[model samples]
Target: TPVLLPLSAAVNTYAVPANVLAAPFVPFITVPGTFAAVISTTLPWLAVPILWCCGLAAACLGLIGRAAAGFPQATAPWPEGWVGWGLVVLYVFAALVLAWGLVDRFRYWHMVLLAGAAAAMLALVLPVTALAPSRGLDHWRVALCDVGQGDMLVIRTQESAGVVVDAGEDPLLADQCLEKLGLDTVEALVLTHEHSDHYGGTAGVIEDRAPGTVLHAGSADWDVDAEVESVAELPASVPVYRPQAGEVFEFTRELRVRLTVWVAEAHHAEANDNSLVALFEIADPQLPVGQIGAVSHPLRLLAMGDMEEAATASLLRRDGVPPGVHLLKVAHHGAANGGTELLEATRPAAALIGVGQDNSYGHPSAEIIRTLEAVGASVYRTDLHGTVAFSLGPNGLEAMELR
Candidate 1:
C-alpha cells in the first residue's frame, strides 16, 4: 500500500473499507456470473435465475463503492514522479523501525508515540481547506475544465452567466464543472467543431440551463441542424448561428467581453483544419483604490479549436496572430501538428492544453512544450493540473490549478 501510494495519482481512502463491506457479495456475483456464462450456450433457460442473482449482487457492490466514494476525503491526491516514491520508501522504513522499537521496549510512552503516528497518517489522507479552490475565487474570469481527452472552457460574463466552448466527451464531468463555477445561464454555447470530444456533452451544458445562443461550424459533412434537433433538451426558441470569419459577437454593454471569429471557413480537406477559431477580449475590471496605476489591459485569449499545422500556417498568413494574447488555448491539445509559428507570433503569457492523462495518442508532445517554454510561456496541461483557472491579479494574470 505504501509503495502504491506514490505510484498512483490519488489514493482512495475508503477503498479498504469498501472492499471489506463488499467481500460477501463478491462470490455471489462472480460464481453465479461464471456459471451463467458457462451454461448459457446449451442451457440458456436454466441460467436465467443465476444471471439475475449475479446482477443483484453486482448492483449491491456498486452501491457500496458509490457510497464509499461520496465521503469527504475519500480520495487524496499524491505527488507524482520519483521524488514521491523516494519519500514514501523512507517513511515506510522509519515506520517499520519505530514499530519494532515500540514493541520491544513496551514502555508507557510507546502508546503516546503510536497514537501520534496514527494521527499523522490521518492528516495525510484528510482534506485540507486551504488547498480547496472553491473557497476564495471571486475574480476568476476564465476556467478550463479538466474533461479527460476533450476540451471545455468557460468565460465568465456576469455573476451567474458565462460563455461555454466545447462541451467535452462526458456529460457528467462537464455538468460538474459548470456546477462548480455556479453558472445558472449560458450566455453563449460555442461548439468549435463537429468532433464528438468537442460537442458530445452538449446536453450537459443546455440541460435545465438558459442558453441565449448556440454557435457552431455549419459544415456540410456534419449536419448541425439534425444534431441540434436531436437534442430534445435544447429549446426551439433559442437561435443557432454559424459565424463567419471577421464577425464579432459582443455581450451586454455592462460586461465588456467580445468574441471575434478569425477562422471559420472550410478551406482545408481535414475537418480539424476547418475548426472555428476565435479571439476573446475581456476588459479588465477597475482596480481597488490602493492599486492604482497597475497595468489594466483587457485580457486577450485566442482559442484555436483543433487546427493542424497546415491550417494554422494558412491562418497566420491570412489574418496574422493577435497581439498581446494574455492566455492561449493551445491548438490540437498541444499535438506536434499544432505549429510553433503561431506560438512565436502570439507569444502568449500562458498556454493551456486540455488533454487526458496517459492518453495513448501521446498528446501535448514534448516538442510543443519546448516551443512554448522557449517563448517564455508558462504551460499548464489538464492532464497534469486538472481544471485550471486564470484571473486578473494586481500584477497580471494569475493561474490556479484545481486537481
Candidate 2:
C-alpha cells in the first residue's frame, strides 16, 4: 500500500478502516447480484428477492464510502509522477530490509533505527513533493489550470497577482491552482458565463485572496441574477460588472494589458452561446532595452469561453475576428460546435483546450484538432498536457506543460 501511494490522486487516511468495514458488504452484493442476474432469465420471482437484498447491501457499502470521504483531510494530497514513485520504492525497500534485520537480530536499537529511518524518509519527501507544482512558474504569463472538464485560465498581472478567467467546477482544485501559482490577489475575476463548470469554483478563487472586481455575462434572456446570487461567495465589497460587446477594460496602471469584450450578448437559445468572449492584449515584458527597429508586439490571447458555432459566426459578422492571435482558448472545451471558421480566421500560433480526461462529452473533437493543425496552430489540451502555460520568449511565445 505504501509502495503504491504515489500512483493515487490522494491518500485517504481512513481508507484501511473503510475497506475493512466494506469488505463484508462487497460479497453480500456481488455474489447475490451475480446469482440474481443468471437466474432472472429463468426464475424471475427468486431473482427479485435476491436482487433486493443485493441493492440493500450496495446501499450500505455506498454509505460507508461516502462517510469515509466526508471526513476532513480524508484525501491527503500526494506527489505525482516518477519522482514520487521512486521515493516510495526507496522508502519501502529500506523499511523492508530494516524489518528483516530486526527479526533476525532482535536488538532494541534496531527498532529505534527503523522508526528514525521512516520519519526521515517522510520528512525529506513531503516538503519537496508539496513544492513541486510551484516550481518553474516564474516565467509563466498565462496558465491554463487542469481543473477537469472545466476552464480556469490565469493571466499574470504582477509577481503575485493575476486576472483569472473561469474558476472551473471544483473549489479545492481551483484554490490549489491559484495557491500553487502564488497569487495573493485576483485583479479581476471573469466568470465568462453563468454555467456551473465555469463559475462553480468562484468561492475557491476568492477565498483568502484580495479580489478586485468580477466581470460576468448577465444577458436579459437568461436568469443570470438568480445564478449570481446563488454563489453567495463573493464579498459585498467586490463590485460586479456586466460589460457589453466592444467595451474595453485596461490594466495600464501596473501591467500593459487591455481586455476587449467581443461577445457578451445572447445570440442563440443555448446558454453556452451567450459565453463572454474577450481578447486580452498583453505587452511583451521580455523585450531587450533600446533594441533599434525591434518592434515588441503585445501578445494577443482570444478567450472564447464556451461560445459555440452560431455565436462565433455571429461574432465574426458583428465584429470581425482579430488577426495575429498569439494564443486561442478553444471554445466549448473543443466541442464540434466550437466551429473552425474562427480558428481559420485567427490562425493563432498556439491553441489551448481545457477538458477532462475520459470525459463523457467527447470534448476536443478530432475535427477541431484537424482544423487547428491545418491552420498551423499548436494544440495543447488540459487532459493531455495537464496544466499548460505560455510566456513571451526571446524569439517568440514559449509553452510549458506541467503534467
Candidate 3:
C-alpha cells in the first residue's frame, strides 16, 4: 500500500570540506610554513579536527548497508607530491591495526579493549562538566559582578571588609565580588534588610566568607541559613548587632558611626520600614583629628539599610544629624518611601543604590531619584553603572564606579 523509498537517492547532506571547516578554528592553517602551523596550534587545535573526522567516518560507514565501522574515505587519488603518499601510508597503518585486532590469535580482547576505552571516555566527560574548584578563593578585586538585574557591592580593606548592600536575586555574583577582594574573608557584611533585594546575597556572603558579623536593623531574616548551608559554607557565628540610637562604633572614637532605628509605621508598611539608619563621622587618618577644625573628620558613609517612610520618619523626628553624611547608600534604593523629607534630614553628599537592571520588581523609581537630587545627592546606581566603591580619608569620599 506504501511506496518504497529510493535506495539511490542522495540524502542531500552537504559536508564541509576539510580546509573550509578547519579554517576558522585553526588560525595557523593560513601560515605559509608547515612548522609554524604545528608550533602555533595548541592542544585545543586537535579537538575540532579530530571530532570532525570521527563524525564523518561514523556517518558514512553507518549509512552503507554493510560498511558499518568501516575506515574513513581517502581525500582523492594520489598527486605527484609526497604529501598524498604520506596520507595513504597513514590510512594503510590504521587499516592494518584494525585488521590485526579483528583477526588476532586472542580475538576476545578487541571487544573488551573497545568497551574499556568507551568507559574511560565517559569517566573523563562527567567530571569535566560537573566539578569546579570549590576550594581556595579567587582574587578578582573590583569585579563588575553579575547580581542578576541589580547590584550587590563589596570593598575590602586590609583588615576589614565593607559591603554597601545587595542588588537582588543572586548570592553567587555577590560571593564572586568578595572573592575578588583577594581575601577568603569578610569582616563585616552589613544588611539594609528584610527585602529580598537588599539581603538577597546575605547567605552567599556569610557562607562564602564566614564574616565576623553582620550589622542590621535587628529584624533581619534567618530563613536562608538552611538554603545557604546546602550549597555553600556557613558562618561559624554571625551576630546581628542593633547599632545604638545615637551611639557610634568607632573605627576610632572621634571617627565614628552612629545608627538610628527609624521605624515610621504608616510610611513603610513592610519590615523594610524598620531599617537601621546611620550617621557617620569621618576623619583623614593622615590629618590628626584636630587639624581641619572638625573637618567632620574625613570620610563619612551614611548607610540606611532599605529604610521605608516609617524608618525615615523616625530619623526625621530625631535630632543631631550634623551638616550631612558624606557617602550615602540610599534607602530602599531610592524608593518613594525615601521621601524628600528623609533626604533633607540626612543631607548626604553622595548617594549609592544597590540596584539591578530590568529587575522583576521595579526599583529606584523616578520619585526616589527626584528626592535624592532635591537633597543635592549625587546618584550612583549599581545596575546601570556596575560596582561602586568609595575611599574615606582626610580628603573626603573618593568614589569610583566600576564598569
Candidate 4:
C-alpha cells in the first residue's frame, strides 16, 4: 500500500488540468508561440522515453498477468492485475495527452486534466489574451474600420471568421461598415482604448451580434456586460491568445502583434495614447520567411493603447524605435507632446490622428501637427474625414480615408 499510494498520487497528478502548464507551449500549431516547443525541443532526453517505458512496462505486466491467469497450471486468478490495468491506462493516457494538449491538437485525453487546463487557462488568459486572436482554421480580418470619433472597426476574413476593432462614433455608421464588409458577429470584438467615442456606440453593435471573442483595453467607461474570464467563455469555440510585453502571440508570423504592457498607474485610462501598439511586420513582398533576414517594414505601429507623450516616450525607450519607416498613431488626439527628436527618428511617411469635432481638448494642436509635418510626414485626421485605414499593398501602402 505504501508504494501504491505514491503511484496513485502520481497518476492522479497527470489528470489534473494542465492549463497552468500549457502557457509555455503556446503558438504550437495555429497560434504562433514557442515556449512549449522550446522546452519540448531542449528537454527531449528525459520524460518522453520514461513515460513510454512505463507505459510499455504496464502493458507487459497486464498482458503477462492475463496470460498466466488463463494458463491451465494456474490455481487462482491474479488479484494484482487490476493494478497493472490501472498503470497501463494511465501511462497510455500521459503519452497520448501531449499530442492534443489543447484545441490545437484536438484528441481526447483524460477528462480530469482537460477540465483543469480549461479552468486554469481561463483564469490566467482571460485578461491577458483579451485582444489575442483565436486559434483555428479561422482566417479573419478586423478593421477598427476607421470610424473617426466613434470607433467602428470590422473584423472578417475569407473564412466565416470576423471581429470588430471598434464601432466608430455613429451606431448607424457601424451598421453601415458591417453591411459594407458583409459581416454579422465580429466573432471577436476589441476596444483598443476607451473614450466614449470609442466605446459609446459599441454596446449597440454588441447587442445584436454574438461574437466568439471580446477583448478591450480595460479602459474605463464602456459597459461590457458580456465580458468574461476567457475568450473560451464567450459562447464560442474560439481559442483567444492574449499576451504581455515581449510575449509574441502571433496574429500571423508576419502580421504578428505583441502587446507591450506599459502602464504605471491603474484605474485611470490613458485613453487615446493608451492605444495598443502592435508591431505588425510588413514582410517583404518577394522574400519568404527563410530568406528574409530582417523585416523590411521595420516600422513599429503605435496603436497608442492611449499612451500619451509620457507613455510613448517611455515605450520608445523600452522598444527602441530605430531609424526606420514611421507609421505613427499620434497620441492624445494629436495633443502636443513636442517630442520632435522622436518624430525625426520615426521618419513616418504618413500619420493618422483621431480627434473629435468641436471637442474641448483642442486636439491635434498646431504645434504637434507641425512637429509631425516638419519630419516630412503627411497627416491623416479622423475629425477631418471619418474612418482611416492603411493596408500593406504589394508595392507600398494602400492608404484611404473612410467617411
Candidate 5:
C-alpha cells in the first residue's frame, strides 16, 4: 500500500497539471493508504480493535503536536531560496530519525542525542523567551505595560520615581517595565486585591529597590478570611498600609501630583468586587498633546483593579461616577460583567485594556470594546499595542512609541 501510494504520487506529479499535483497541502498520501490497507486486510473482529487503537494513537499524537505548537513564537518564518529547502530537508531528516527511534527501541546513543538536543533547544530558547517590556517613555506621566493578561500601571511621579499599581503576573516582566521607565525608586506599590495576577509580582517590584510604601487591600471583607499572602512576599523593610476610601497619597514630595483611591462601596463578598479602585489626579494645569485630544488636566487616570460586575455596580450606586475622568484602565480586562455604565458615566476620552493575545479567558470581550467606542473612547490594548504609554506634558497627553 505504501509503495503504491508513493508510486502513484510520483507518476501523478508528471502526468497531472502542475497546479493540480502541487496542491498546497502536506504530502500525507501514504499515511491514509497504509492505515486503510491494515484495516481492510485484518479480520472483522480484529479490525474494530485495530481501528480503535489506531484512532486513539492518532488522537494522542495530535494532542502532543498541539502542545508542542503552543510554545510562544514556535513557528519560524519561511526562509527564502535554497536556505528554505535546506531547512525543510533538515527538518524531514530529523523527524524521520525521531520516528525511527520511536518505531524501534531507541539505543543508549540515541537517548543521549535526544537529551542533548533538548538541552540545546532550552539553551537557545531560554534567553529569547524572557518576558521583557516592549518599550518605555521618558516623560510619560502614565504607562500601561503589556504584561500579558494582567495589570501593570505606572504613574510617573518623577524621572526616577513612580507609583506602580498591581504588578502583573510575571516578576521578570514587571521588573523590566519598571526599569525601562527609569524608575529607580518605586514610591508606592498598590495592590488592588488578593488575586495572583494582580499582586504576583510584588517580589519583583522590591527586588532591587524597595517601594516607599506597599499598599494592599488588607483583610478586606471579600478575601474569605484568607490572608493577602502577597504582602508577606514583600521586603521586610518596606511598610505596608491598608488604604481606605477618600485616602490621598503622593508619589513624591517634589512632584505636584496626587492619587485619591476611592473604594466607593463599603465592601463586597468577593475579592474582585472589593478591588481598591483609585483615581489619580495630576492638577498640573499644563495641557499636553494627547493622541485623541489635549490632556488639559495633565493626567486623570482611574486604576480600576480587577473589580467585577457586582463591585462596579456597588461603586456606581455609592458615588455615581467621578466627573471628568480622563483615562480608564478597563475593568476585568473588559469583561461584560459591569464596565459600560462606568465608561458612560465618566466618558473617558481613552480606555486601556491589559490583555494577552489569544488569551484562554477570552478577555477584552468584543462587547466591551464596542461599548468603549460607543461612549466615544479611543481604546488601547496591551495585546494589540505593546506597552502603550501616555505622556502628560506641556503639549498635552501624547501616546509614546519606541522609535
Candidate 6:
C-alpha cells in the first residue's frame, strides 16, 4: 500500500491537467489482458513486441505533456498593488489546501479540487494579462506605430482626433493602425523629410480620409503624381505648406496641445540633413498612472527626423537645445549617425526608437541605446514592444505596449 501510494502520487505530480497520469497506468491494466488474449490466439509472439512499443510511446507522450504544462509564464506581466499580491497569495494557499484534500477523498471530488486550483490560478493572473486595460490608452496622448523600419507617430488632439507625424513605409499598416485607434481624420499630416520610409504611406493616409493640411520641410520638391500613383493624390487644394524654422503651428490651443517646427539652414549634401524637427508640448495633461489623486504636469516631446550629426548640431546652435525634454524620438531609425551629442543636449526622460525586427541596416545602434541608458533615460523600442505608446494626464504618466 505504501509503495502504491507513493507511486500514484509521483505519477500525479508529473501529470498535466492532473488526468494524463491515467494514460500510463490505464495501459498497464489493459495491455497485459489484451496481450494474453492475443497469445491464446494465433499471434502470440507479436503481442509482446506490440505491447512494448505502444506502451513506450504512450509513456513518452505523457512525460512530454507534463513538461509542457510545467513551463513558467515568461510574458505575463506582474500585477501591481496590494489587491494583486493578496490575490496571488490566496491562489497559492487554496491550491495547496485542495492538493492536500485530494489525498483523503479519492473520488470525482479529486477532479473538482484540481479544477478549483486551476480556477484560483486563473483568477490571480487574468488581471495581469488579458483582462488588464492598456495603461497608455486609458488616457491616450502619444502613440508611436510599429510600421517596420520606419516612423509613424500620432498625437491625440481630442477623443476621436489626432495629428499624424510621418506615414512610415507601409501604407496599409499605417492606415490600419489609425483605423484601430478610431481616428480617421487628422489635424494635419506632418512629413519630416522626403525619405520614402517617412512619407511612403502618404497614399494610405489620404486614401480614405484626407488631412486638413500636409506639412513638410522645403528641402526638395516631390513629384506628387509618382508619389501617390498607387493610391490617390494629395488634394490639389489641400494647402501643402513647407514650414520654416521658428514657425509655431498651433492646434487645440484651448486644450493646450501646441507644436513648433525647427529647421536648419546649413548647406546639405545628404538628403537626411534637411530633416524637419519639431517640439510637441502638452500643458498639464491628465495622467492616470499615479498612486495619488489626479496631478497636473506639462509634457515636452521632441521628434527628430532622419537628421544626421551636422543637421542636429545646427539645430542645437540655432535653438540652443531645450533641456528637461520628457520624450525624444530617436533619429534615423537608431542609425549610428544618430548623434549621441543630441541625446546629451536634450537630456530627455525617455527615448523612443521605431525600428523593425531583424532589420537589414542594424538600426537602433547598440551604442546609441547604451548612451541613452547612460544618460538615465528609459528606452522603449517598437522592435521589442511592437507599437509603443505614452499618456500623461492630471494623474501621472503611463507607458504601454499597444500590441
Q: Which has the greatest lDDT?
A: 2
| Candidate 1 lDDT over residue span 97-210, tens digit each | 577776697566666665566565546423432243332245678899999999999998887788999888888878888887778889999988888888888888888885
Tens-digit per-residue lDDT, 1-403, candidate 6: 2243222211123334445545556666476757756684678686767677667766776666646444443123334456455555665666676767666765676667667767876776665545553333545677888898899988877776778999898889898778756677788888887788888887777776778887776256554345554445777768777777788876663345778886733246677887778888765333343322122445777888888887678667876886557889989988989788899888787888889899999998988998999998888888898776786533455676656
Which model, 2 or 4, shows the larger TM-score? Answer: 2
Residue 353, candidate 2: C-alpha displacement in angstroms: 0.4
Ranking of models by TM-score = 6, 1, 2, 5, 3, 4
RMSD of 4: 24.7
- As a whole number from 0 to 100, the lDDT of residue 4 in candidate 2 is 53
Off by over 4 Å in 1: 1-135, 288-296
Write model 3 residue lDDT over 95-174, tens digit each, in one string. Answer: 45556777774366665655555555345434632342211112111223446554455543333344334435577777
Q: Report lDDT (CA) for all predictions.
A: 0.79, 0.80, 0.50, 0.48, 0.67, 0.71
TM-score of each: 0.65, 0.64, 0.52, 0.48, 0.61, 0.66
Which regions of candidate 2 are displaced past 4 Å? 1-135, 221-225, 289-296
Q: Can you give the lDDT of residue 202 in candidate 4? A: 61
The sequence of per-residue lDDT tens digits that candidate 5 reaches over residues 196-233 is 78877766677776788877773345441233343335
Please state the error at residue 213 of candidate 1 in Å: 0.5
After best superposition, candidate 6 residue 79: deviation in angstroms?
Answer: 11
State which candidate, 1 or 2, has the greater TM-score.
1
Better of 3 and 5 by lDDT: 5
lDDT of 6 at 354: 85
Provide the lDDT at 242 for model 4: 37
What ranking of all candidate models by lDDT puts the best one first? Answer: 2, 1, 6, 5, 3, 4
